[model samples]
Target: MIVAQRHRPSSSISDDFETQGEKSFLRFLTCGSVDDGKSTLIGRLLYDSSHIFDDQLAALERDSARHGTIDGDFDFALLLDGLEAEREQGITIDVAYRFFDTEKRKFIVADTPGHEEYTRNMATGASTADLAVLLVDARRGVLSQTRRHSIIASLLGIRHVILAVNKIDLVGYDERTFDEIASHYREFAKNLDFITAVPIPISARFGDNVIHRSTNMPWYQGPTVLEHLENVPVDDAYIDSPFRFPVQYVSRTDRDFRGLAGQVASGKIAVGEPVVVANSGKLSRVREIVSMDGPLEEAREGQAVTLVLDDQLDVSRGNILAAPDAPPQVGDQFQAHIIWFDHEPLIPGRSYILRTECDSVTASVTNLKHTIDIHNFSQIAANTLAMNEFGVCTFGLQSPIAFDPFRSNRVTGNFILIDRYTNATVGAGMIDFALRRARNIHWQALDVSKSSRADLMNQKPAVIWLTGLSGSGKSTIANTLERVLHASGRHTILLDGDNVRHGLNRDLGFTNADRVENIRRIAEVAKLMVDAGLIVIVSVISPFRSERQLARELMGSGEFVEVFVDTPLEECVRRDPKGLYKRALAGDIRNFTGVDSPYEAPETPELRLQTIEAQPEALAMRIQEYVERRT
Candidate 1:
């Protein structure tokens, strides 16, 4: 008979010799705040389970003596956190993945970073994990970082959560403290959609309730962490939820053969089953499912194989193949929860490349509804989302795409926003659902034409936007220009900012987020007037370039003219006709564009007027003359 080691690894982690053939695999993650002992817990698991070799143990002891965090005892963290920087800082900086096996199962545990700034890295680890082991310091109880990580794990669709209350020894192994923390976490989790959350108190340093049950905790009668890992059910329900295959590659071996190659994102595929092209609604039956060995009769979710269709249908990367009868919802608009990751704040109305699987299209955030407060989980109205911020917003795609609600099908609903110029992934979004109106409302073909409307008025239908500082004479010049147009028998309307605010936009404030929405609403109104074949002159201090460009896109090509009324800051301050600048300079006004907030100048404008150098009447004449030449 073989002698069991002094450290009896749980039955789940029985020795390699006593193990049976073909163990199943479990992929999990360990996450929490820095110094919460995530890496140490993994190292303890590896050491106590006998996964560490004799040589590795000796090396760990030697390193522990020189720079161990806990006196001269063996520092298990040194084993998992392999980076030199991690050793020096005594914190896990990057995600460290380790593979180990026991009698019942194999395991892949990701030890992710815990700092708030490295949230994106944590998100990456959560994406592939079937279970998330959330570590919390027993002495500290619940924390904001812990809540944020839990929210992320839930958002990524990980239904199983293991709340590992680490370092119980430091808290005197008190059962009351453990229960209190667990209760707090449970109350917070009520808002989250995760299915199950199990709390277990453990001393990762002493191997208590990890691979072995602890003698100190006589009151507790739960399975060890190792035992829980062995029993936790891996959800394979996605395989039966719905069939969704994003075409990633086109395998054309020769003229005789062509295959649509991609991993089965969800559900199963079998020969003779009908599949629909999500983008084009083209239907075709599956002819063959081929693997490396040969043709297979069927393939399930997570399998990589080549699919041969019965008919010669047009299908390429970025196209989604789905069940013919239960098609994904198709639309050009969505309400989504997005996490911003780029250094630059997400600019509303700025065009980005929205990529889902292989499909990439021009897209933009049409509206920023509100942002989530991680500390208390409250919704705060926002104009833009900064790095690591989560916000609810509306998205507009250049073209319609097929998708399911993210809660129902992650493969078909999750997308990333890539910068058009740099191609950097700036944001990750999960679709709540397609906008109701986007699916229900269809554009009605109008009988009256834009050309006919303009002809009836006998003039050009244009939108001349006046943009500059507060006291830059934009309104004065616009008034003069409208008078000149009226004298010349042209139809015109002057939408002065102050006049509109008294009625249309009285509810809006001067916050950056509010400012973006202010411009968005005005742009829509301008588009409507331009369609009516009237010369619409808009005078406002539109500060941001992205919002200005959005207004341009709303109008026809060459119909929107941006007039930059350039005035020196000194000149504007001296001529603070409304005393607004005086209050702004005195710190009474907040989010005042030039005084406090940011102002992105137009890189190139249709017309430029230096108000400080010339009279308003002269500038108005110049603008009128330019319009006449263009029309």
Candidate 2:
């Protein structure tokens, strides 16, 4: 019989996996937009680890003969180019998953495509990765696609990043070159919120420092590719993240046993422990924990175990079981960061499926806050998340669903959006806020309306609406100014371009009418919030002067602080830190601002600040001065 290695959990089960010596496995994915050598890197890891089967090797040899060899040897890419179309084009066009095991642990690697058309597939591949091994070629270094993947990884709550600097041989494996790449990547990583990150140098083609130490690199002294995978501190496993087990299937056996069956997604559960059901809010005791082998004393995270409760509870698929001490909140609305993968933009009123673990519900895009420029990590005013764009968007669920913050429990908090007709997963979302607090605060006709409350609080509901072109430093200035006002005990809210686009404004598009509507909605919301006694600050690339004027008309006179975050188009495109300017120049993008659309400069404004120096501090102080004068 072929031996299948089974990982045994440590006895005397402490919450910490380190104490038990049972190193939890992390499934990491390698993703980029395109031409990032994702498949070749996976093949290199598989081949170097001596995991290639004899038959697979024979097939590779035949393919190499048929297609002609790259270096008169087997081309590893031949193994990963699965689809006939992909083989013909010699590019990864689908999500390709490969599995291997090292002495220390087992690993499941997914090599995802980096093409714009395969964005949905990329999301599917990366949805389950505990860590994302984002690859950047030494020749190309950091590209827009690289940044997109990094942002997605962060938004998806992939806590760890192993930035594999692939194709080091192309850059002569020079230490200076590697250091430069690492330095640039480090700067980018600052924009992300991962728990830990490590940059490593590797030549996937030659298998340099993959499974074994590299002979060519004398300057680099670190673990091999396999070693890093085997021993990069597997402390990030979500075993302690408050027990969250989504009931996948309920079983009623012939014997007197009815149990809830599903994978223990996070945390531990012991027999006789008080557990809370998420959907029904019913509490019960875990009489026994069952697996394929029958009864068990306890079950830990990531284990596919079933539990028989003492009381016969009405639990079904999508229902979550949690510890009573830290029960998950159930809500019909959740604030999430979504990445739009559909060809059609996400319509705010349209309903789609939001799938988290075993739970699936119809969810509507309640708000599209803002869209993020993945390159420079800046926000832009966007009403809808177009194809392959990342944004912060909120979803209104069909029913109350139990979930925790993605930061606390990824399995419980993360969800995927699906097209109803094709059942195709079009987007991935990470929960930011539960929205239950908003429910409590949104009681109609109870004590007071939100606007009246704000009025009583002595703050007019107004958005210090700042409008400008790309690279106008709207966020930088707004953030600094908000901090100043907040320090002065003025209730302030800074709605930045990128952070909001990721959520609230995600449903709006870049078209002229869409842009107008986008600003209109934000202005209305800002007015309500101001009426609720908050000094709301908003920064957006609102190109249409008429739209800005209309938003101003919505607010009371002097309440609307129309600030013009002015930076010349030439300088804006020059700073093109996000490389959007390069994409626009390449003719890959259409209807791009400053290229296809006319940007009307504000004729008259309360404040006009130049952002040519990339310093928003001076502009921020100017705005602070204006706010001080007004208040």
Candidate 3:
């Protein structure tokens, strides 16, 4: 065994120490593969730092006897895995945050899960963290999850990392073992852009090299985990960056007082500083900086203050205030990295609600560039992103918004994608940069408007969309409806699903991605036809409800009519007019609606045509009457 080094005096490190209230704050997270002892390491830190209370310790001892996994010893993991499901399963399911303080620093540590299914939970914890504690089991060194967490940490802008090789006692505290794991990890992490990747051998269960140096590994000479954490530099670069204030709310006390209330996202603002609205380019000057305690001379990064402008501009919630000389990029198109969280795969061309710090707008992923392969860190071609998958995509917004690149400012660069129908958060994204085309393209004014064109044609513009399963009578009814409307001297056009495939959508296939593109193309065409003052009829087997909703949003309110052809699957299969169903069932065709593929019926449609209840001519006449009344 190697001899232990002589004890050094505490004065050698006195310059790095600070008093309690004056200590700097650090936010960090612990993450790794399942059963890698993330929760245990955090629990040890709290216990050794004298942050635990007697009552809490008593409760912990009692709980440890029942649910502990350490052969009746104190289970440090019990302190953080609080949920009953987590305790019973001996795993972390949600992100658990705990706050503690040392003499030199204050800390808010997030204990994240290690399971593959809960990777999204890990990302949530990493978002606000400045550093990451990546724990790895000594026996299972450098697993795939280790690479995945490192990639996520890098993307989230964390520059510092601690590679805690836990369970060192199980490997006999061997120096060779620790060196091999540390060297291998450093080789893999060199490309991740981490400024510091310090490897420390620790046994969270035994508390070795955690808060105190380990006697078992005399060959290792490094600062304990707590020592390194207390001395690491905290990133405060936002203070030097350009000013950014996202207007959260407009505070109005009386007719003469209108103050914009928000936290300064970056830089500083003073009473006389000139500011501009980022999206609108309206100029203004800060008249007064109002805080809760009354007027203040200035406010810097992270301070929440209200600013009274010298001029009355049209600024409101969702407008960003910035220094006139360094305004953020304003555009409607961008390239971003997205981590999908929902079970449903992300479909391109489907509209979602994109929510930023203070703005929400309709947005869609126009193209998926590639998905990262966690095992090899390689980019693979993909059309969609599934749950727990990360991809680089191009996003198109309905309206322009101001933003900075995520590397420049995390607060102004991050956004979440919400499902338009369910309001559930489906994906999290980071803006890279605004696309050049979005800034170059401009909408030119036209003398002829939709209303003017409609008046000239003597009718209201509309798009009637018919959706149903394959082999249904949608095309037949559409043909009959157009004939009835045309005979009445109404300008109309019919766009059938099969006819368009031969010309407009000739490059498409039967995959889900191709189907989405097919519906998108048809919707755009129908909208153009409606703008030209024609009653456009679209007949297609639009299987997905999301794509149908996308089509509806492209038109004006109440101008898009959804007609669901409610035909029984059995009836449609028997009628198989084009023999498509026969081929699908015999394995000659795939992705056939109502067979291998799913057809989501509309929950609420404008018109429900029961084909079995009436003939095609009669149903078409009913549709014509409804259109006449609606128009």
Q: Highest TM-score, which number?
A: 3
lDDT (Cα, tens digit) per residue for candidate 1, span 391-500 = 99999888898888888887788888887656787888889988855466668999998888999999889999999999999999999999999999999999998888
**Compared with the true structure, what per-residue lDDT tens digits does model 3 show for residues 1-631?**
1111222233533333344556789999999999999999998898777666656677678888888887657687999999999999989999999988877888999999998888889989999998999999999899988998998898888999999999999999989989999999998998887999999999998889999999999998988899999988996769999999999999999988999999999999999999999999999999999998999999999999999999999999999999999999998999999988898889888889999999999998999999998766689999889988889999999999999999999999999999887788898999999997846567899999999998988888899899998777999999999999999988999999999999999999988888988999999999999989899999999998888998998899888999999999999999999999999999899988889988999999999999886899999998898888976
- Candidate 2 residue-wise lDDT, 1-631, digit = tens: 1111222233312333333355356687888746667777787777766667666767767777676236566677777878888877777888888866655776788888888788777777777887788888888887788888888788776778888888899888888888888899889889798877788888877888777778889998977767777876666467767888899999888678788999988889999989999778889999989888877898998789888899988899889999888888889987888888888677674557788888888777878888888878788877678888888877787678888888777788788888764577788888988775457655455566656776666654456988887776777778888888777777878776666667887986677656656776777778777766788898888776655665676677677888998888888788887888778878877667787777878888888888765467778888877876775
TM-score of candidate 1 on Cα atoms, chains taken together: 0.79
RMSD (CA, angstroms), candidate 2: 16.7
**lDDT score of residue 467 within candidate 2:** 83
Give the per-residue Cα lDDT of candidate 1 at 69.
Answer: 81
Q: Which ten residues in a row have the lowest lDDT in candidate 3?
A: 1-10
* lDDT against true structure, model 3: 0.90
